[model samples]
Target: MTETDTLRERVAVELTRARERTLTLADAVDDHDLVRQHSPLMSPLVWDVAHVGNQEELWLVRDVGRREPVRADIDTMYDAFQHPRADRPALPLLDPTEARAYIRTVRDKALDVLGAEPLAGRRLTTDGFVFGLIVQHEQQHDETMLATHQLRTGPAVLDAPPPPAPDVPVDDRAEVVVPAGAFTMGTSVEPWALDNERPGHTVDLPAYAIDAVPVTNRRYAEFVADGGYDEPRWWTADGWAHRREAGLTMPMHWHGDGTATRFGRRTDLPPDEPVLHVCWYEAAAFAAWAGRRLPTEAEWEKAARWDPATGRSRRYPWGDDDPTARHANLGQRHLRPARVGAYPLGVSPLGVHQLVGDVWEWTATEFTGYPGFTVFPYREYSEVFFDRGYRVLRGGSFGTDPVACRGTFRNWDWPVRRQIFAGFRTARDVA
Candidate 1:
């Protein structure tokens, strides 16, 4: 197929997938829940629904088409940065029906712009980047809405089939050595890569050995059982303060005796599931308890991208291809992480599993600009949070859609955050 045809097909697939997922997530609950603020941290579902379309219209139609906004009056109502999530419910947001109609109307115009548009010769559309960006933006909001669903206290409003059972038991001792060298640490050519992930640079990382898979609940439980929470040495000053203030004994949504714990309203899971909902502090403390440190961002990316045989970087841990169901547990296809070591097909060249999905893996790096980072479209998307005591998270979560999850896609949250889908694997200097 022609390259432009390929781009058009991709645009169509991504747009449809993003919209459908958003609709499905919003439809899972009743109309009242859709417009209600389930949690103070998240915008109302109805707000997210309309904001998704508003963003698409702003970028795809207005920016690409060079046309004035069709609904300029409602722009402020949907501007996320203008209103905190807690106060968004007070705005005059469109109802679910109106939201659906608004998104459909915007989408109809966007599809028309997609065909007549050239693939390049512009800043944002340098290889249809804006289209990809819009798709990613819509999918990211869908993920946020999914978080709201999880926080909503009710019987399960969403359901999905469990991931395929692992063919082998997980080995907690599995760590792979990524050889010492200068490896490409970020994306240079990924058309849809965000501004923070741009301008790939060579990182001279010393040799390190990292966990082949993420740290699992079975292992984290051992730390908790050993007075890991009560002890202060393993935690930082800030972490210890937050720990005591919040009275956190275990990962959020967890409750049990030392023998077993359950997540939210789910059934009791086996010990092999990757630990989730733990903040950076908890993950770091657990790593310290195990006599390991969390991988630096450079080390994590090297393990995920380097191919020792060819001495080149792959777009993803497995290869330079778009993800598929056979490769990773992503796109809300499953509501929870698969058992560790399940998606062997998604393994990196160095044999790292669960690097792309199942959960967002925390890294021991602060959120900051790259060497040549410059504002694009606006600064609110990533730059504002660069200094708000946020740390980096790699990989995507099961709640993340494929359009939003890429090898270089970066997620950040405060170290004290626990409601989000976050997890981690540990690394150590090569001995």
Candidate 2:
């Protein structure tokens, strides 16, 4: 039909899919399971689910001209910041059925209004921002819920393997060599990227040879076999200390038998599959053992996206369509890491495999602000992580929201913490 009709249809589909995702998540756990908190900081599943629904109402109905769907008490039940995790036990409980109903009602109202309106050119302002944020927020909850279930429930149900990678023809050695040049990094136009990727700036990168594909399990296995973990020479002093403290011998999900198994599902570590679950130290050691280094954040960004005109500043590696399954492993049905090299089209201009998904690739640059960098109006996102030590990780993982998987999206984890879905690729400065 018309463009407006098309937009409405897409919105309807998104709402329906979100509702289905919520239902699936709710059904996966029992009421008893919902009450239990997996971590001291994380909210209980029931509260989290309700919070997702409540967010929809707050943004769409209250903020977007639609009528409020519930009593004001609903706010008190789901304000996460107001009702901290510590206070969850003391807060009034919401029956699971009632909470689900409220969520469904909010979704239904949003669908109705969106379908009726002609919103093609209408610039989304505050309420629209909330709508997008809530959708992504729910997706994040979906991932966290799965992680919580894994932690709380025994591995029996939680340990199913991620689905097989979609059969895309892969040429294992198809490499893209990037000639070095100066480029502007980060997002110029702010749509929905987090504060960390904001206030795009320029960066110069030297000519470097980066692997066409992420380091594979087979490749990393060679390093491990050669005593990469035991040798301190390969690791930075800080990395060495972190490794010693954690007592890590190999990648987190890798088994003694040498197969890459995640959540208890065994898959052949295809030589072509990008190596995953590696922390920064492990990545550095692997690079050292292999005579290479991890790409600097600027170098990685340049290879991913190269702007031709100014010879500076690139937006996305694959030129910015947002990430799709055809492009990357993000937003897959399986809630775990994927085999690297699965998505060829998603490769950066430099031909790196799985740059936007499968796993987050750790970069060499420490987390710091660009020149003239200022905190966003919202403080908690990036400002808290600006200490001297933390390193940047580019490319979102399979567990990340597809909408959130922009080339500019910047994530950082402590070099020592390997529990999260993090991995790395290598880059060597040209000789």
Off-target runs (Cα >4 Å) in candidate 1 are 257-264
Model 2: per-residue Cα lDDT over 294-405, one tens digit each: 8888877777777554464445567746555577666646656556556667666556666677778888989977776666534555786787589888877767767556
Model 1 poorest ten-residue lDDT run = 257-266
| Model 1 agreement with the true structure over 167-273: per-residue lDDT tens digits | 88769669998888897777778878888997788888888999998998889889888999999999988889989998989987676553322223656646888
- Per-model tally of clashing residue pairs: 0, 5
For each candidate, the alpha-carbon lDDT, in order, equals: 0.86, 0.69
The TM-score leader among the candidates is 1
